[model samples]
Every structure is written in structure tokens, then in C-alpha cells.
Target: MEANSNIPSSHTLWSPHDTVKDAAESLGIALPDEAAKNLAMDVEYRIHEILETAVKFMRHSKRRLLMTSDINHALEMLNIEPLYGYDNTQQLNFKETLVGAGGQTLYYIDDKEMDLEKLINQPLPTVPRQTTFTAHWLAVEGVQPMIPQNPLPSEIKSIPPFARGATSSTLGNDITSSGLSSDVTMKDRDDQSRNKNTGLSQNASEVKPLVKHVLSKELKLYFDKVVEVLITTDPEKENLKYAALTSLKNDPGLHQLVPYFIQFVAEQITNQLRNIEILTTMLEVISALADNKTLFLDPYVHTLMPCILTLLLAKRIGPASKDNNSSEAEDSLKKQLAVREFAAILLDHIIKVYGSSYSTLKARVTRTLLRALLDYSKPVGTHYGTLLGLKNMGPEVIKLVVIGNLKIWYKQVIEDSNKTDYEINILLNTILDIFRHIKVEVDNAENTSDGAQSISEDVKLKLEERVGTKLAELILEQPDAIAIVRGIFFGEINI
Candidate 1:
């Protein structure tokens, strides 16, 4: 006879002897050992056949795992009846039951029957209450109130040395700030320093000291309100910002606020350089303050110069974009250039308005812009802005300072392609435009200066040497380049 290769081996998980024998005996058929073994092998082969079919269903369903429904389908495909009461509706809960005979353990599903009316009659649990809070006095006049909620007198901390006389948090000083003595605040500071050096503990007082300048609470409130409105980035706050700027410009009582505003501008510019909006707003603040006719800003003009100059001469103004090719980078570059231009305009305004008060203001500002203009290390935008500033100062400045140095500066600017052509073109346009205007203005001042003046070959070469060959060519391209160059040869356009 042929070997029955389908017979279950010892590795069979469903042991043929124990399980198959039990199933057979349950049906009153006392299965012999050989018969049990054969039945077990047939059962195992059938199970494998069903599972193989089920795997195909699972794959067609785009699933990695086999489901009960897949097995059901697989049984139908094999022309065999599928088992019931084992599905994925819920997890199978097995109840442990031990038979007393041999202490044999068996697990079975426990589906308890319930009284439907009893379940319906059960009452719901009570609902929870909403939350509430109570308030108490924490402190008064910088001293803790002796309330149950506050610490006892003995538990209170000592006042620090500098804070001895202050009433406002940071703005106040102690008894010294009482307006009784001028030097008391300074001396108290010395005492605090000495205490620190000697490891002495200075008790913090609950008493807040009076602020310096004895500034009214109204001033403090106004300063806070103005700063908040100016610094906000919300589009909805535009009207509020405009109102705040208007108040800064036109308010007569802002005399006391000038120094504070200057200090605020200086600090913010230093700390928030990347925040283009805030930086631009800060410049607007300066413009408003300077525009205020009622206020005297002479003492603080020099103080404000550093902030403006930083903006004017900064290589990059706003936050740098992550990708150079992105629109964000282009926008940032444009905004930064605009900021430099604004700073230039503000600088010119300050010189024109306050220049006479301080005789050297105009001269110093001119020199600064000239230096920045000639500086090849600066970005192209900066040179362009500097040129704008010179033009704003007067027709004479552009003629005297810019007309002579255009070639050398522009040569290096174009050679280094670090800045984009858009920037370079803008600069070139500005220079060309300024040269054209200044020539017309100078020549017009002399007469209808449309007449092109002649120049010698030697003068043209000198012109190339002074300003590079490329610039000489562009200058010659202009209608009045000869007249301008001829004027330069003579004393018509001064350097």
C-alpha cells in the first residue's frame, strides 16, 4: 500500500490522541488509537486548506491580518460549513470553570441573561457642580496686608538696598525719592554695593519707592499705552497705531516723555533688530517725537542718531529668509531696503530741523553718509540709501560728494554679486537719476544747461581713472554726460 503522507506528525498542535479521541467518544464511537490518528490528520489537513484559502481573501481585501469574515468566506469556497458565535463584534470573554472530578480546567464564554425592565428602571448618578474662586487683599503700598492669607510680620522679607525708597516697582526709590533730598538715592546705591561686597543681607521692604523725575502716574500710563499700540502687529490695531503716532507728534504735553521715548527706541532697536515691523514703527516713533513742535528734542538728537545710523548702515535689516529662492527672501530684502530709505529720510529731517540749532549736525551727518556711500563693504542697498540721504540734504551734497565717487564704488558693487541685480539696478537707477537731476539743477542754476559741453581726450581718460571706464561710458550715455563731465573739468560741478 502507498504511504499515507497526509498523516499528522508529532509536531501537530491539536494532538491527535487526546482531542480526536475525545470528539469520537462524545459521539458514542469509541475511536481506536489508529482511527483517532487518521481522523486528526484529516482534520489538520482540512484546517490548513481553509486557512490557505482565507489568506487569499485577506490579500484581496488589502489586509495583512485574517478576519473571522475571511474565514467564513474561505469555508464557503471550500464547500464546508463555517462555525458560528465567534466574530469581531466584541472581545471574547472567557469564564474559568474547574471540573471537580480531575481538577481539569476549561474556559467558556459567559453571556449572562439580564432583566430588561430592571435595567430601564435604574436611576442615573448625580451631576457635578461648577468651579468657583475667592479673592483677598495681597498687598497695599508695596507692603503685604496683615491678613490671614498673607505671611505674618516676622515672615516678611527685608527690602533690598537699592529698593529702599522706591514706591513704584522699578521706577520708584525709597525715602531718597521722597523729593526731600537729591543725593540720597545715589548714597543708598553705594551702601547697597558695600553690603554686597561684605556679604551683608539687605532686607527687602514692602514699601515701594517714588520714581525718579517724580513723573506722574498719567505719564506712566500714557507711555505704556503708546508702546503697546506701537509694538502690536495686528492689522486690526492699525487705527490705534495711527492715533498713537498722531498723539506722539502733536501732543504738547509730551515734553516729559521725550527721554523715555528715546531710551525705549534705543533699547528696542538693539534687541529687536530682526523684527522689521517693530523697527520701522520705532523709526516712526522717532519721527513723531521729532515732529512735535511743542517738545524740545535738541538734547536727545545725538542719542537718537545711533539707532538711525544702525538702520541706515546695517547690511541686513529684517529677519533673513531660510531659502534664498523664496519670495520671503525677496520681500525681506525689499523691506530692509525701505527701512534704510526711511532711516535716511528721518536723518535728513533731523538735520534740516535741528541742524541749525547744532551747527555741526549737518556737517557730521554729511560726513557719515559720505563714508557709508564710499564704503564698498556695505550692501548695495545701503549705498543707495546713503545717496538718497545726501540728495535729501541739498542739491549741493549730491554734486559735491556723489558725482565724483560713483565709478569706483559702483564697480566693486557690480563685481560682487552677493546682492541681486534688482538691487544693483535700483542703485544704478538712483545714481544715474541723481546725476541727471544734479546736472540739470547745477546747469539750470547757471542757465538752460541743455548745451552739451566738450571735453578733451586727456580729460576723458582722467574721468575713466577717477570713475571706472564702465561708469564713464554710462555717464557719457546720458544726454548731458558731456556737459556734466565738462562742468567737472571746470569748477561747474564741485567734488
Candidate 2:
């Protein structure tokens, strides 16, 4: 018998290449070529219609139980990305049908681990009875940039004054120094320009001319509702994290809500009573913010630095103390570890962009970041993503921190006999770097000085003893870093 072709090809997922011929062989439905083609098209159309409907439903669905598994799977199949509230517009993409929905319901889905069975078994009517075969067409999606050029939402017209002064030059310099591809360079430039404009409030609004703006009130209302759900007593409700992030996305001016968002993240990382999933989501939010420099200009940008630093430092300090009654005492060390590593990257950007404008912020940020890097020097606490950031900020910045921190460290550790050979070795390398940059800057400063008096013997001797000789040895050993050292020295002198 000729194969019937009403059924979809193969018993598994459908691919574009699957046709009536394969469908007929697999599902035993036979038909003429025209009929088979028409039927196949109909099936494909139906599948898409179902998916569109699913996506729409998931987008605004308030049913938490349904969202965790069934709705999530559907989203995965549909390839719909969840929109960050920071995104000005929400798009409901559909091919054929299922476009008509009752209302645009603001759905919240935390991209965290959850028990699919429990979610399904919940007593909510919206909860799935079984994995709805058709439900696989739905999803809440991930965040994407509204425009190809302006990857960040325009609402963040400028970074906070201090943050802009701190990160712009550093972020740009790092990108350029690292010899990154053109795309990365362009992005850094855009970010820097935006940040530079943002520093002066008068120009902030004009920075992002084509920024996408949505109805801010509607988004705020939805966010408020989501916050209500988050604080409620529902064990199955896990949508708050995404809701908070999305809320910030829609109305970045809702920067006031940043504290609430930070609190939520803190609860996840510190509160033993909270789910690990929440903590993981916090990390995701931070990574997202870091990846998009545009968002770094938001008013909440100031708060983020300390928050990130605390998280990194917490890791080094170890887990919460078992005996502590107050949760603060238990997690203090963890908080420190959390901040230490993360702040390094943020500061690196701050120093590179704002140049001398960020002197005050740079000093504080560098002090914290340098200390963390030195502390974690065995492998350095931060991974490659942020390491390249430190390198871009220049060896001088690193050296400055080293010279500053080394004294403090020596006072605390060496005098107290608290550190080991490993710690001392790390300090040595940092000091070596500092000296190299210092020598370069001094030479450049002297060369540019129009017949200035020669340096006093005493100052020269002090510098030579402190940094020059060691710098020479290290430079001779690794010539590649000499250029970087030279760049920092000359850059500072000229400025």
C-alpha cells in the first residue's frame, strides 16, 4: 500500500525537511500528492498556530504551576526569548493564527530550577494535567536587545555620575588594549559615549535618541503585582525574580526599586531559608547587567558595585557560621568574598572610561578590587571574563592599588606573620608592575618638562629603591607587558 501522508514525518520532533512522504510512511495516512501537500501544510500551520497561542498564553499567564514545566517546554520549542522589562516593547510573534488573546497578561517565570512534578501536581486549574503535547509550543522567553546597534535600553541614558566617571575610560581602554574584534570595540565606544553623556544630567536625555519607550505606567503596575506575588506565602510561586528584573527593564527610572531587587538577591545568597534557585537567578541578573554596559548607567548602578563586590568576597570567606543566631553574622564573610572579585571588573571599566574625573571613585574601587585580586592571586578570583578587564584598565592602576595595598598588607600580614610565601610572591609581582609603570611615567614627565631642574637625588634614590630595579628585571623577563606599562606611564603623565 502506498504510504498515507496525513500524519507528521517521524515519531519525534518535526523538522522543515519532513514532508507528506515521510509522514505517510510513519503515520500510515495515504493521500494523493496534492492532498498530501495540502494536509502537510495544514498540519504545519496548525502546529505554528498552537505555538503562537502557547507563547501568548505563557507571556501573560499568571498560572505558576503551569509555567514551571509545560509552559517552559513550549517556550523552548517555540524559540521565544523572554523579554527583560528593561526592554521597551514586548512582541508577540506569530506566523498564522493564535494571534488574538484576551488581554496582554504580564506573566512571570523565574529561570531557576524547580520540581516539574510538583508544579504539574499543584491544585491549580491552570496547572498541567499531563505534559500537554500542544503546550510544548509556549514560552516566556529570554532578554534581547531592541535594536542591533543600541543593545541596551535607552532609558539608561547615562551612567550615574560617579559610575560614569569610574568605568567609561577603563571599559573603553580595556577593550582597545586587548586587541578585541571590531564589534567589541564599537560596543565599547558606544557605551563610553553614552556614559560620558550620562555624567552630565542635562545631556542624559539626548544620548539615546532612538530609545524605545513603552507605556511606563502599565509596566510599573504589572511589576507591583509581581512584587506582591513574590512576598506572598505561595511555595510554588517562583516568578518574582524574573518579574523584578523585567520590571527594572521596562522602567529603568523605577531605579528606586533597585533596593528591593538587591534585597531579593541578598535573600537568595544569604538566607538559608531561601531556595538556591533564587541565588542562581541573582547571579544571572548580575551577569546580564555586566554584559550590557548600557544598563550600567541606570541610577541603581551605584548600588550594584557594592552588591557585586560583597557577593565575590563572600565566596572567599566561606559559608555562613553555624552558631550565629542573626543571619548577618553567619554570612558576613561570604558577603565580603562575593564583592571582592566582582568589583574588580566593574572598577576596571570605571577607571578606563572616566580618566582623571573618577579619581575619588577610582581610588575606592581600585583599593577594593586590587586587594581582592592580590588576595586571590594563586589563580586570581575572577575568571577570564573580568581578568581581561583588569589588564585593560592598565598595569598602572593595578600597580597603584598594589603599592597602596601592599603597604597595608605588609603592615597587617608581614608584620603580623599572617601570610605565606604564596601571598608574598603575589605581592612581589604586583609591586614589580607598579614600579615599571612608575618609571615610565617619571621618564615621560621629565622628557615633557621644558628645561625643568633635574630630579632631586633623594627622590630618585627612593623611587629606585622602591620600584625601578625590580621593574627592569620583570620587563626584561616579559617584554610583552612593557608596552602596557609604557602606555599607562605615558597616559598618566600626559593627562
Candidate 3:
């Protein structure tokens, strides 16, 4: 076996002069001299031959003493990575050979056939990406992994490659010598596949140690790479940015990244960012993040208020050119439409998640959102008209978002629609919700008891009659608004 295991020659790996020809073709230049031609032609083949020799050394050795000591000694003498590339290729092949051996072991013992590709490509659960943004501690070897004792700079650290652990020499040698999981998609499958090679199938419960090991070591590194890709100028990076945002939205543990997303929006808007594609993507991500109450309001609600208001106003104005032609206005319509759709979705999310806490803010936003819807006389601005169908269902849950800021709503709707029936109905519906809130307060304040009638019957009758009559007049004048107004007064509406 030893005699037959001679290293393959350069001639076996590469045809003479092929490398020089390929190099010349790639560079689009001719070799200047014979020495250059000879060096270029044979260099690649020489490296391949040396690696082949190292692979044969491993195959023939009985004790499997495939040592790197000789190569490292050679590297030190050479003062560079050897043109040989033997150590690198040896480390790779030793494992492949071991996996092949392990496949044989399984076949001999259990009479089961192995499909290398399937064994390698199986999917595993990924750690939620949001977890990386949190400043949580990790324990290793009964001690917490400490941050630097000396103060470090504020810049984010580049994650380092995984280092061999304390037990690596003993456990690692056997493991590294045996085989690799054929899957490159999995971060550390070879180490994970060890128990299975020993006849233990890794089920969800059994995979805990592998998960912990990878999460503690590799997850941070992977996330850092993702972040790097997301912020780059490469067009391909958009896919990564989308994935990162989606992961952030789904992750419960990593709430801190939510602010980073808000900051990304702030930065884009401040720069008068032209990448509308990214803006739309950011909007979708924000809408997803807003699904959680803590995510929607914490650290973001205040900043988001101003940003949303500005964007919505810009959208209302259409495009910036003063030409005032129908074509110009028509051309600008797409941006406004996009803004309206995004704003509706975002506002919907906020109302659902923050509920009453966001009521004061909602009132302010409602004026903006409801303007086009309420102003029936003025052709119902495109933004409001498109979203007017929203009004037909019921009042927005956060209708009282502005609470005492009734003037904003009045000015926007009344100024825009002096005689329109739709405008009148919108105002009536909103006023009804306020009245319902007032009634709730009054009822709660005076707990009814037969012995102690809370207030004079006359006073109660007057208040109810006044409120009911005003509501009736509004409803009679605009019957379409009746459902909303009644819904509000009876507290049947979500808001």
C-alpha cells in the first residue's frame, strides 16, 4: 500500500504551458519572457502535486499519524505559506476520508445505505437574529464570558473566527481525523454529526448541545456579516437587508434592534434619501416590528411621530414642481400612493399594538389621515379617497389619539369641505366617540344606587337629550355617517 501510494506528479494535475496560457488569456497580456512563461505554466500544477502527496501520506499510514509538523517546519524555513498548500489540503481530505470511513462503518454494521448529499443538506433551526443586539451575558466553563476589563472603543468589534476549546486536543483530534458533515450550509455540522456517526440520531431534544455551541460561537459572527452586507452599496445586498429585517421582526428576545431600525429610517429621511426601494422595504419592516407593543412604542414612538408627520405631509402635496400641469401632478401620484398605503399599514399596526397609550398620538395622525376622507366637497384628496373605504367599516381604534386636539381635525376637514355631506358625517362620527368617552366618565363618577340617586334626574335628562339631539341632527343631515356616529356613542366602536 505504501509503495503504491506514490504522490501524483505535476503532469497528472496540469498540462505543461496551460497555466501560462490561461493566465495570459485572463490578464489579456502576453508573457514578457521565457522565465515568466515557464514559472506561470508550472506553478499551479506543482502546488496540486504537493497536496496530492500529503493526501496519499494520510491514506497509507496505519496509525493515521497524518502530521502537519513537517509542513509547518517547511513553512517556517520558507518564510511564507508554501506554494505546496499541503497542510491545507491535508486537513480538508483527512476529514473527507474519515467521513467515507464512517459511512462504511454504518453500512457494515446496520446494512443501511447513506446518501452523502441528503445527510449534508438537512436544514437546522437558526437562532433568531434579533438576539445579537441585546447585551446579554453568556456563561462558558462555569464563568461568564466577560467583556474587556480595560475600556474598549465604542466601535462594534469585528467578530473573530472560532478558536479551538480546552478539550480540543483530545476530542478534536478524533473528531477532525474521522469525517465531516458534507453540508456547507450548516455552520458546524461535522462537530454536530459526531454522535450520529456513533449511532445516536440527533432529534430536536438531542441537538441542544450542538445548538448552544453554535449559538455561543458562530451566531454573532454570522449576524455581523449580515449587518455588513445590509449597509453596503452592492445591489445584491438588498436581499440580505430584507432577510435581516425579517429576522429582526420575528425575534422576541432582541428588542434592542428595533431602535436601530428606527435610526435607519431617521438617517434615510434626513439625507433626503432617494432610494425609494429601500424606503418601501424599511416601511414593511417597521410595520412588522410594530406588531409588538413594546417594539412599537419604546424609544421609537416619539421620534416616529415627527418622521411620519413629515412624510405624510410631503405625500399630501404630491410632487415638488410648480408646473401645476396635470401630467406633472399625475407623475407625482405614485409617491403619494405609496406613502398613503405605507402610512395606513403603519397606523393600523400602531393602533392595534399600543391601543390607548397611543390615543393622543393617533388623534394627531387621524387629522392627517382623515383629511382627504372627510373633505367630501373638495374631490376627496386622492390619499383620503383611496383610504376612505377604511371609514365604512368602523372608526379607527385610535380615533381619540389626539384627545383634546379637536381643532386640528376641524381645521383639516371643515376648511377642506365646507358643504360636503361626507365631511359633515366624518365630524359627527368623531364627535360621537368623544361623547361616549364622556358618558363612560360620568357613569363611573356617579355609581348608581337606588337610595342615593347620583345627580338630579332633570340634569341627567338634559345632558342626554342635548347629546342625542345634536347626534340626530348630524345623522339626519348625513345618514351615511349614522353607523359610525351611533357606534361611537354606544361605545360599540373599537376606539
* C-alpha RMSD (angstroms) for model 1: 25.5
Q: How much is 213 displaced in model 2, in angstroms?
A: 20
Clashing pairs in 3: 98-178, 99-179, 359-401, 360-401, 363-401, 363-402
Candidate 1: where are CA atoms >4 Å away? 1-211, 322-326, 441-462, 479-495
Whose TM-score is higher: candidate 2's or candidate 3's? Answer: 3
Writing each residue's lDDT as its tens digit, candidate 1 over 105-208 gives 99999896899999999997788887877777565423567778866765443644443433233222331122122365568767765765567445633456
Better of 1 and 3 by lDDT: 1
Q: Please say which candidate is ahead in TM-score: 1 or 3.
A: 1
Write the residue-wise lDDT of candidate 3 on 30-131 in tens digits: 754454545644676555555556556556554355466444444445464654533434333212222364464222222346999998898877867674
On the 0 to 100 scale, the lDDT of residue 299 in model 2 is 36
Candidate number with the higher lDDT (1 or 2): 1
**Poorly placed runs, candidate 3 (over 4 Å):** 1-238, 273-275, 292-299, 315-328, 356-495
Clashes (candidate 2): 46
Candidate with maximal lDDT: 1
